[model samples]
Target: MTIALEHPVLHSTAIALPARFQASYTTRLVAVGVDKRPSDFWLETAGTPQAGDVVIARVTAINNHKRVETPESRKAILFEGVLVMLAYGHRYAADQFLAHVPEDLGPCHLVAAGGIAGTVTALHDRVDEPTEIEPLGLLTNARGTVNVRDFAAFDNPLKVEAPNKRAQVIAVLGTSMNSGKSTTLACLVNGLAAAGQKVAAGKITGTGAGNDRMIYHDAGAHSVIDFTDFGYPTTFKLNFAEIRALSVNMINVLADSGADTVIVEIADGIYQGETSRLLRDQVFQEAVDHVVFSAVDALGAKAGVQELQAAGLHVAAASGVMTASPLATAEAAAVLEVPVVPTFDLTNPEIVTAVLTDHA
Candidate 1:
């Protein structure tokens, strides 16, 4: 098999690969859905890059994200001039950078460690500039520009039918980024698994990163998947309709996995654009059976609970970073009717069963 490179500077037309030459592209986790065999595709220098379009780029400068997560979920250190296989996608990280897919395959920033390339529009004060990369070109084949959605694990058209034997769906939401949502979700998974319940987990939203998914798997979930499994690098800028479909699809997929219970983590906070929309959507509300709100403080906990309650969601309990503080916990528990279960307590099967079963 032969691979060709199409670049005006390199050649007037496509050039064939040398017989001894081999492609050694470092494929990122975001492109894990696509086949990694370089020989299966070629590089097209012409065309506008769109969201989810796979691209081959070289690191020009290192900054915030010094390493890129690989397809194997391993973090590979990045260096100048290192060719990487990533996807063009938008990013929304309040603690990091807010980025959008570029109009062309021009120089952009590595907005996410999960291997998302985009143009950084805004960033938090504490975060350094995003790592810069020069887009070589979009990956292409006989079908034209390759997209992550082309290899989605569940690509069937959206059919939001109620599962006949669906698992109990528990959703974990937080006040904001790093509000302990993933931790709470993991502890819940551990506790439920410890209680002898078959559990499946999915992260329906958020940037394409493996940290939360890894935590869920380590917590003993029978199966684990995220938005990446459905070919979305991030759900930041997606419309409410798209987000709703993704949410329902993920829930149905996890339920169909044969687990008795499905625990899902909704990335970001209650106030996030997509999160807020999902919270208000009738379909989303019907899909989730219980909600666990995570917050960093008493104020956030109170506000988050109110938001969930207003959305007509059943708040099971409150647990998160605030659980680390006795005063904060008491303050939140006093103002809110829901019990403030500490993170450690959440890992106790008895406590978890009581909280969820009582709510049930």
Candidate 2:
């Protein structure tokens, strides 16, 4: 094999590689190209690669502060391993890929734990710079350039069906990331399970991360899915049609999974482009039977609730970081005219029963 002996093959669960490519590789054959863009690659490495196909690249840079999220929600712990990143173009975030995949296989950055690869053009002040990495070579052999699309769930084609009325959907929205959307959904899943309802939960938007899915599983959800399952590393750049199709397909998948209730979470805030668009879609709105908005403070909670109400979604309850503070919860509840359930009380099966029963 004529591959460069630069980086070792360090498999990261972030990309689902074929069994053949799982072995230790000192050197391997690689057909390099310079025209493919990052957005051209899939999240998994399981398919035949044509001239424009994207392959899994072994990122050589490892920064302690920048860790990759594994499929099971475990961190790859950068210092000890090489990061496998997906080279793709991002629309909403600060980083993006060069117009074309570099034939030289030079340096790049692990822009997202979900294995998004690109050059860091900009970043929020709060986050450390993206962990830099090198594109050692395309993870490939005699077959072709392996692409993330090979292992994607949508490989089978996601045909969206009408809303499944048999299963009630509890859509959880948040004012922003880290606003306790995952926590609230986990608690609600636990509570619903305790109430003897088989629950299926999924994170519909945002970047691909197993942490939220793991939370749902730990909360006793019978099944959990996310946008990653639909072949997207992140939902930031997806068009409204694509987002709408993925959202509807995800809900239907959960409903078909035999879940008595489906708990769906749309990442980011109501004001986010994708979130706002989905909220405004009449069909998407109909797919959701109940809405629980999460926020950081009383004001955010009130605003989030108003956003939902204006979109024609009935805000069932307000929860999240605000609920941690009794005063904030009370204030939000008063203004929003909705019960503010604290995180600790979320597991109380009574709360789940009350909400579901009331909605029923």
Cα lDDT tens digits for candidate 1, 1-360:
112333223333222222221122122332332334535456677788888888877789999999887665677788888777777888888898889999987799999887788999999999999899997777776687887777777753565754454788899999999999999999999999999999999999988888888899999999998987787877888877778888888888888888999999998888888898889888888888999989999999999999899989999999999999999999998999888999878889999999998876
> Where is model 1 more than 4 Å wrong at Cα?
1-37
Compared with the true structure, all predictions reach lDDT values of 0.81, 0.66
Error of 1 at 76 (Å): 0.9
After superposing all C-alphas onto the true structure, candidate 1 shows an RMSD in angstroms of: 3.6
Q: After TM-score superposition, what is the CA distance of residue 88 in candidate 1 from its true location, in Å? A: 0.7
User: Could you give candidate 2's per-residue lDDT for residues 1-360 as a string of tens digits?
Assistant: 111223233345223232222111101111122112222322332332222234445546565236665444566566523434353435244222212223344576666665555556566766665676655455443344554444456432445555759798889998887799999999999998998999999988876566788889999999988876665666776667788888888888899999999999998778878889889888888888889888999999888888888889988888998888888888886887777888758799998678656744
Tell me the lDDT of model 1 at 351.
Answer: 99
Cα TM-score per model: 0.92, 0.78
Clashing pairs in 2: 38-87, 38-88, 39-88, 39-89, 44-148, 86-115, 86-117
In model 2, which runs have C-alpha deviations exceeding 4 angstroms?
1-54, 58-65, 80-106, 139-145, 154-161
